[model samples]
Target: MPAESRTAFSFNNSINPSTFILIGIPGLEEIHIWISIPLCSMYILTLVGNCTILFIITTEQSFHKPMYLFLSMLSIIDLIASTSTMPKILCLFWFNSREINFDACLVQMFFIHSFSIMESTVLLAMAFDRYIAICNPLRYTSILTNPRIAKIGMIAIIRGSVLMTPCPFLIKRLSYCGTNVISHTYCEHMAIVKIACTDTTINRAYGLFVALVVIGLDVLFITLSYFMIVRTVLSLSSKEARVKAFGTCGSHICVILISYVPALFSFFTHRFGQNVAPQVHIILANIYLFIPPMVNPIVYGVKTKEICHRVLRIFYQKH
Candidate 1:
């Protein structure tokens, strides 16, 4: 085929070229207006919910516990992750097909991955906290003291940020000789890397490696922590101790499942199930990215009684 014909064929094969396209479910445009309303509401709720969690944690003296510290870190990650993607999506829906520069896209991708990794790490840390609290309650205070918790939080942030730094740099090295249109809504690493005109073997390998490292390590550590926790709970002399331990870890587990399962689905879909409908893909993508933030505050508030009261107090005081 002639070069011009080849170019034309590639262009025709892809959905949109000028900008990233949001592949929604078939006939979704009919309900796009309605969908937009709820999605916008959720976006705002996610922001407020996470921000409120952060505020309460910062302001409330009683919430300075190790578990709440991890919750606060999760809230910060959720805030950054949700803000990194949603505002631009809302702009695209409301104003125009927003165009992101290459550098900006890279930056967005970096933060998205960074925050995601951090959330996962923070959850692992939370599991460790629960493990310490339940498995060795006698030393919980000594082991997870304020200064120690602060150190762990700092380590989580540093590790997550450093791990994701290579992603943007790797993406930058990839040549974009062809059209720059990204599929899906956000600057996701897989979606953007797919458009590289150069060989993307390294990109794919790196992505898979990073996913395995972050998700795999997190799941492993959490499972180990919970295993120890369960063993400890079972051996407890009183039923009350078991109940308390379970209660303390329940919210963290809920948040972990909410965040990790969707992420795994999206990762697998992008990696193995590319032929799926665009709308299905987009919906899963959005859920994978957004739901954690929206539900995080609720999980913490409902499960952790102190945070709930603190959040309510803040609202009541403001009014």
Candidate 2:
């Protein structure tokens, strides 16, 4: 019999309420301490940066506009998403605590994936906000009223929660007769599902479905929004007006690329890339979670004059 068959035959019975061992990075165990340095720094920066953004938005009444409201939502999502995984990861690296309760793992997985979906939707909403601001400045305020923005925020929360609600329950139904070692830092949906001894077609299919539908559709709409925005910008007669329109969009475009590129790469590698090393896969997964939350505030701080001015004002007052 094949090695795969032999391994399957060894653990035919299901084990309920298993404990999963998370190996920080499979091949890089020796450098786990060294690796913690940058990850820790990034996590700190993510907290400080996102908190600053939220503080600025909340205190400044001028920031009550749609654009800033969407940014505040994004900041909140980034805070929770990064916090959901980083603390446990740090513990794994520094204290060598690798064991996570199966139920806890499921909770982590749900929060991570759900918040990710919410972030994507918020990005899509931000794209729509840009589209209206540039394409129909006259109606921008009327179209994206406070109530409408509130509805968009509520929908993002509901859509993400509803879509990811099935993942943990689906995972619970499976039997983990095999070794319960998860090769990654956190309880990623597929990572947990892969250890199941039972048939996992439902979990796999549903995971793929959510990825394709949520990410696929959001990307499609964001692309179309930018396409229209570009067309409108070019139609403007003055060079300064065109420059201003594109300038407004430049930060958002950078943010979109930062958020999506690693995410797409990680998703494809998980589904394909059988030849890829485990360490690479695990590192990419960490990056997909870490980089966006860390980089978003920095990108916006540099590009947004209001945020920069507020920061400077805060510093000046302190001095």
Candidate 3:
């Protein structure tokens, strides 16, 4: 009856598991050539930016601090998140290779969601580091040692892997006889699961549960940490000290907003905005997941003065 339903119905019946065609950014097939330019630019920038941050943090002993440790972790997570989807997306756009194997699809979904969760977890660690630095300056160094930060990073990896390990199995159990055509460029869990001919009650339920459990707890802790940081900053005796303390938080605050706001909006849109155009949903999904990775390094580049100074010094010396 409806056009969208009709389109879905056709694709639903076309799946055979030999290969699923990824429809990249629906309704823009004619202009995909134009689209690849911008997308490739972003991928290149993301790689360069995140790698540069990693290089600076690793090589410079001065950056051997808890805050920079979290920053380094964030860069690595961003790299993982982008690599999970962007290469395939770029392939789809550039070579017109829409066919992805079923196992590959499953792998993509796992990495994308897992690294996303890990990134949020890393953010929580960073928030706690800042809270301690600002609110308990006397004990910050004593408490947050290099070993402790490394442990935090290990925990983040474990948390993401363990939480998301069951997800691929959930989808793998489904019978996808109807259609294998994925609407988005990459294999998002919901997008892949939606093609299942069988009842998807379990898949949907488990996904929501994980989202709420993992992201929900991380957000709660981060919010509380910031709340305490703000309280501690405001009570400081010297105006200059208060300003400096808050300034340390400003970059992270911007990063949190950039990462969470779009992601939450995209998540809700997928769940609630069923009537929204499929193209809009796909585009927003890309923005939510990809934009942060592309822009985060840029944000930190401007926000962290030491990073900027070091980068400039290297360039000047090379010249």
Best of the candidates, lDDT: 2
Candidate 3 deviant stretches above 4 angstroms:
1-16
- State which candidate, 2 or 3, has the greater TM-score: 2
- Indicate the residue-level lDDT of 237 in model 1: 88
How many backbone clashes are present in model 1?
2
TM-score of 2: 0.95
Arrange candidates, best TM-score first: 2, 3, 1
User: Cα deviation of 45 in candidate 3 (Å)?
Assistant: 0.9
Candidate 3 per-residue lDDT, tens place, 140-205, comes to 999999899999999989988998899888887787667667888799988988878988899999
At residue 267, candidate 1 shows an lDDT of 86
CA lDDT scores, all candidates in order: 0.78, 0.92, 0.86
Q: TM-scores of all models?
A: 0.88, 0.95, 0.94
Error of 2 at 70 (Å): 0.4
lDDT of model 3, residue 122: 88
> What's model 1's overall lDDT?
0.78
Counted clashes in each candidate structure: 2, 0, 2
lDDT of 1 by residue, 1-319 (tens): 7332344345554433333343333446456556667779888888888888888778878777888788888888888888888888776566535467567777888888888888888888888888887777799899998888888888878987888888877877766556565656678888888877778898899889989999998899899988888887898888987798788888988998999999999888888886887677778988988888999898888888887777778778989
